[model samples]
Target: MSEQKNTYRSIFLWGDKKIRPLEEGVRALVKEQFGLTEADLDQKYLYSDDEVKLDIAPALSEKQLNELQTICGNENVKTDDYNRALHAHGYFFGELLKLRKESIETPPDVVVYPKDEQEIVQLLAFAEKEKLAITPVGGRSSVTRGVETPQGGISLDLSENLNRILEVNEINHTVTVEPGIMGPVLEKHLNKMGYTCGHFPQSFEYSTVGGWVAARGAGQASTGYGKIEDMVLAMHVVTPVGIIQTKDYPASAEAWDLNKTFIGSEGCLGIITQVTLKIRPYRPKNTASASFIFKDFETATLMMRKAMQSEIGVPHLFRISDPVETETAFRINGFVNSMSDKFLKTLGYKNNSRCLMFVSIEGDKNYTLLVKKRMKKLAKKHHGFYIGGSPTKKWLKQRYESAYMRDPLMDAGIMTDTVETAVPWDKLIPLWKAVRTYLESREKSYVMVHISHVYENGANLYFTFLSPMKKGDEVEDYRVYHQGLIDTIHENGGSLSHHHGIGRALAPWMENEMGSTAMGLMQAVKDHLDPKGILNPGNTLGLRSKI
Candidate 1:
């Protein structure tokens, strides 16, 4: 493959391993957080199993392989075991454990990179005729194994030649681009043009625009810019039947919005080849942030709800870290802890018994100042103590690096994962307490939570958990632990997922999230669109027996 082709490397926990070994400083930091000694470190870090060899399925015949090669160039089609293995599992902890052990069960037969929309169309027809399944993937950053290859299929790696910024409608504040364009690259181009897509998922650096729309993602600043579903004005998807291009209009009175159906379809119905997204000029205004410490979780959440519901101004970035997460986050970052000692402790960080909320606002210089001022007033009303701006600024700088920590944590024999769900404000407290209580009772895991993407009526809760691997049964252990959380989410009336799409990990819960009738309608739609069941089977709709 050419150097440009290599530009499509995966990194969000699924790609190549290039992280430096735990340096002495990081070791010291971890020891401080987890209270481990040198011997303990050695014992924990030495956990490794013999690389369980992969049982790759048979490859395509020379003629069949040549047929695909002719469609999208020889270099774009790969049948090597290594490349196939890399595209298999997603970033899920269980998947990672399997990867670390080299125990992949379902590797794709062949991986193909289509150069353009026409090639994708041709490839889909070829797959249909050959009875081969197709899975569309970009950056392969799925944490739910959504991008995993089917039992036997070709993984259409759309990240290669299809990546480009096709057009920028400066007058209308929109940009049209091929689907495989990486998030950071697209954002950089928009920034150069004094505009931004403003969809900054944690996976921004490691994911693609197509993947964002596929997942219907929400960014850290979603309060101001809106979610991916809200940002997409139009999209073009290619399926076995034909191409679907949603209308580009500000408002539609149509009975059913087709774009909404395909926005979070998760590549089940079709392949998203091109997207026209709403963009905004770079906010060239003053920005300020402040941190608040609430005495309890209830008060913190209430304060968040009030801030979001108030008519003064909405903070571009808002987050409330629960007590356990607040402490854990500070403990892991030694520099931030040192700063707390010098400045924040006097302002109440010393207690370490409070939930933390970081609120940031950006707009007209004077308006931004007023927003921060109003935020401080609201916080005090809800029994919040100011902890200054250091923490919030620190959080902004390191927000994207949070995903990188997973690899090292796994290296240290710790199993870590995050799950998110949304619920209305009234039900937030119950869901929050239920999740923490359930996990605490089940596993010896550390759980932390934060609220983001706050709406007037509801908000999203993101929970992160970590625990030592249970010997050789890591996968089974994770399954049980994760199932408990999912149950809690559903019981408390939260959506099965807020931003993360329902990939294979949560496919079984589709019926629970959506009643049988609704789910049947979705299945009916899928069946009509992909009659052969050749598209991403066992994804959002779950695996089904042949009709």
Candidate 2:
């Protein structure tokens, strides 16, 4: 067999008794290439019994079951375990794939909650003993299929078990929180202590710190502070083999640092349980946003590109909502149409606007004012009229609720979703125009975009579209949208994903994203960490057969 095929075959035969001794060869290839040891290869590298069962599926071996029961206890696990496990994976890509994609289901054979790091180690050991395909589920808020298991396995839902503020190191100005704590709660908890974790996503209300780190998620503040990779100081993870602790280090003369590998592993290399994240002492933030009257798309897009490449207007949050999204968000917010008779006529603000650039400056009032001044001067140079100010009062009132737009579309049975990517300043405008053409050229729908996060390197724009969710062919339509978006994005020198990860929906095209060399290394790392192909299989960097 070809080496690739042999690798695939070994993964498939991992559970057979005859394969145990020979599993060493499979393990050796992974270990030698990746610098891992036998303990790393042992299914028992961490702890467990063998009796856990996902659901209606048969219970695992006595050792596996005992390990799971001991780790989770009988508290919240029982006969209803099956549905509870299945429900935990619930979230739709489109209404159509809901049934056809069911086969990919590998529901956790038994869901377990580890109350502490010690219990998690035991659970990981048990998962290794039974060679169970283990999937780490944090918030279950992924729009892409990051945490879904149709057939059944062991899902480690960290929400309840890891919900605690383990430490708040005032000295380092960093706070340590368990993975399952929600975004608002974490921020609220830290805020009272005169610190803030500025990461925010549309799903911020429901997302957890672990999920943020695992997905490498970004926030509005990313333009200023960077992604979770920047915010995380140290991470505590339970890999398939054992617990890997990345201690907090300010700087190191050491040649290599291991903390970065876990940031965007997508739960392939390890399961993130506790994160020590950098916290900024609370700063009163200010917003100085104004509407620009742009005559057309290209001019507005150019202005945005300059703002990104410019140093003067370094912003906490910067966005240029395209006419379509701006119109949609405003109307949905009842701000535009409900404009009492006077506003629209006087300001000439109508659905006719081609774009609206929103910008916010953070840190201190002086810095915010300086940024706003430089931004205003730069905007004027591009014919961008600074017509309004200070979140315009009205926009701030409705700013946080923009996520509800998707709900009505979902209710209307329209399958709508968004994809995000980032490109350098030079390619920014072309990428936008290209993405627009690709979406508009689609067979059955309209696609539009809006710039969200702006950075010195570039900016992030979100492209979205929706169509009637066809019954049997939902995957085809969803593929049409996603493929069109991702391909155009890659062709234009943008990333396949800026934040939302390479979940099951994005797996097939991972090659285009990671490239051959990186993907090869990722595969080696995956093999080293999960030789049995049991750690969140078929998602990020696994074999083609698994995908």
Candidate 3:
């Protein structure tokens, strides 16, 4: 096999281990936004150590190590400093700060690669007996610190061996797969069978099917394909108590929906061993793309709400960027002074005020064409100018690439992050203004907002903010900003998170968001399933005091 270029040691960096240089246009945009000169940009904001050095040692004894080796093979069980360091924390900004400085406080005692469900069952049993915390790691793509091994027992590395497409049910239009299967692997396998899962999150290249189910994640095309929860038909989870397998039924009045109990559990309830999801036939020829320029963010949202409620059909990828984001998009994509720019200006679409919308419909040719036509009519009725499908195509081509921009920005003395929340149509405008206002209030900050995964009653507002990094106080500054953003979202009547699950980052706010009674109920479920509290100690639900 060819050597792997990217590994967990370089988790601080995005994609490959190599540091990607910022594009000239992006660098210029950053400088303009942050009021920085060429000399200011020359200074590196963050520095990552070349060598992995964590002083912490494994807590597991030789006997315990042998026991794990017995469950998995000897080669599958790892105790090296690098492997432990790799599983110490996730891709959370705070964790990245620590990784860059090689200042990890706690590292997992051992990393285990279970080959199959049977091995997972055995490992869970062993963990229960030994009272060891086990954090199920899929792709290590968690930005919420969801995969951190705070309790330092074991890091269950599923992506190693427990990754395979188990079955493809053509008649039922569903596919069953092992939980460790990454999005690209599963999608490729499904595409070969002329079907698609239709879930394409920005982290699609690195995230896993189990991670999606565990976090209740949504893809970029969620407006049409629905979120991961909607696609998951059945699940087989291995809790500390026992295995709970939900039946695969189209619709059922089944007792209490155990599937939901574990869907967003974040490995607190159990480890998702296997999953069966609904799949759609691949129909790229039937896909339709369209773009529109609205006078402002509010107008674009109004048109989106109308389109969603019209019952005509929602687009597979419906998105509207607020004025700031629209301006940023224009600048970064070199849309300024272009023919499209002059044409838009001629039609009263001015920069810094005009919002940009991208629409994509996927279905049968007739259905897609009909939806596109009706959506276009709605846009026109709302004074939206049709800007052709080129923008949408451009966005589709660079959707995943945008995530890589964060690392380069961080390297150039700039701090960048994203926070998303969902709100009803009535509260969308207020929430948008409130969060945007708070973010922009910060000094040297550039805030961009966008609406995606739209619904009839509401839509998701995703905010991307960039500011000058406080070199020595990166994590502390991040905490302040992150907490303020969460508080603002809560105060403005927005969901804590739309797609990203309540990992450790959001665990503190769970009670405030879900209420005390609801939290108690969830706690009860967690206690019953994980009496020993060995599965992901500090995770979505909250920090557990036990093992």
Candidate 4:
């Protein structure tokens, strides 16, 4: 383990735990998991000042303040005038945002809570008239710095007007919801109706439908259900000119459904108000998450690829833990009384191996059993051994419950984050190697890669980077590390982003990805709708001179 600041030592579900009497597979899993040892258990992690840092907020200019007030103009609206509204801003987690000084020093000039679509229309019109840029804000769980308001702009908080469920079409098995409605509320409503949204991510608790759509977020169950872009049937986005509602829900083949374009637009195009999504009857999920020890990262990656493309069967969720991540999950456990470190060591697993894959098959029992058998056979191809039903199932159960145990690490202020990108199988291995080479070169505290979400044609390889930031220099480390990852992604021919939007974080790469001609079309579309460039200027675009 390296010196990490504010970085939480990952309590490897079994990764870091010292074990004696470990057999071949268990010892292999431990060795493959992480580079930590019981001797290094008390290693201090560093937190980045950048991690806790935000822009300095100057007092709003008279023109900016007045313009924001009129742009809102909602009688009871909370601008800086009629009402002082509570502000919600920051990354996905609220741990840092709740700090008043952070929000105040880095405050948004105005937070408008419009109550209806007409208000939204009026606001956009007002911004256009005022020649001001407007940033569409949702649950404010954005980590890509996506929701941060640039200097001199209006932060349009859509919570008030976009929180209603418009229609629940039982026949079509879909639900139409206001863009402001966050996931937890919507999920509860659906569960009561014996239906489920079928999407669960770490931010699901606080993220909104519109935010998810705009970001093209992936659910944990994306293998079976699909990403937000796939689940969205239709959306009513407010263009700069007027409200542009898709012709019909679920789209029609008569012409291209332009709505698909906005699903991952990242608010570069317009503000989304209402979204209709395909839903299904709630089926109780019976999941079996187990782990295995692999000789190396290549073997685990290959096994994951096979399972994802397997015709016989595949689990809905397949996550592999690199040696470091496995170690973090296991060794960092502060509460390990029953399992002795000596026992784990005896399992033939060295303190270091290459990898371990966590797999979960969920659905009807009969189908899951069949899938499990098929998956086991597929594993045999990779020389993978499932420790029967040992520590694996318990590991998967605690994954989503990460929130409960994650706060301590987060509170420590480490530059802790994960980056994911989907690449075709051919390029996947190469990209993974590229990422590893970059991280390893930096000599950071911990760098682990996993195939969290998989697909038939291709799959997503997610990398979690945990580094200790030097005091007063977190920003530099973050900038260097992030640039390395982004640059490597470009060089390796992988998307700079997969689930997260290309907000300002990825804005630099958008042109390269979309190319000149396609980028021109986006500009043309923006010009046709928002000719004045009043909405989210400088996002998802390089130049709008022609458009």
How do the predictions measure up, each by TM-score?
A: 0.91, 0.81, 0.97, 0.80
Q: Mark the regions of model 1 whose C-alpha exceeds 4 Å error after superposition.
A: 1-16, 20-36, 43-54, 333-352, 543-547
How does candidate 1 fare on TM-score?
0.91
Sort by lDDT, best first: 3, 1, 2, 4
CA lDDT, every model vs. true structure: 0.79, 0.65, 0.87, 0.65
- The C-alpha local distance difference test score for the whole of candidate 2 amounts to 0.65
Q: How does model 3 score by TM-score?
A: 0.97
In terms of lDDT, the poorest run of 10 residues in model 3 is 1-10
Q: lDDT (0-100) at residue 275 of candidate 2?
A: 90
Q: After superposition, how far is residue 228 of candidate 1 from its true place, in Å?
A: 0.6
* Highest-scoring model, lDDT: 3
lDDT by residue (tens digit), candidate 2, 338-370: 544135435544464556677676777777788
Candidate 4 minimal-lDDT segment of 10 residues: 6-15
Candidate 1's displacement at residue 365, Å, is: 2.9
lDDT of 2 at 41: 43
Cα RMSD to the true fold for all candidates: 3.6, 14.9, 2.0, 7.3
- State the lDDT of candidate 1 residue by residue for 374-469, as single tens digits: 999999998798879888998988887666667666767777789999999989989998988887775456788999788989999998877777
Q: Model 3, range 1-547, lDDT digits (tens) per residue? A: 1213223336577654555567788889888878888877766555564566668778888999999989899999998878888888777887887776668788999999999888999999999998888999988888788988778898999888988998999999999999889888999889888999999989999889999999989999999999999999999999888899998898899667778888888989889999999999998888899999999888999999989998988899999999999988898778899997998888889988999999999989999999999999999999999989889998999888788787767767787888888899999999999998899889889998999898888999998999998878888998999899999999999998899887899898888878888888888888899898898996556746477
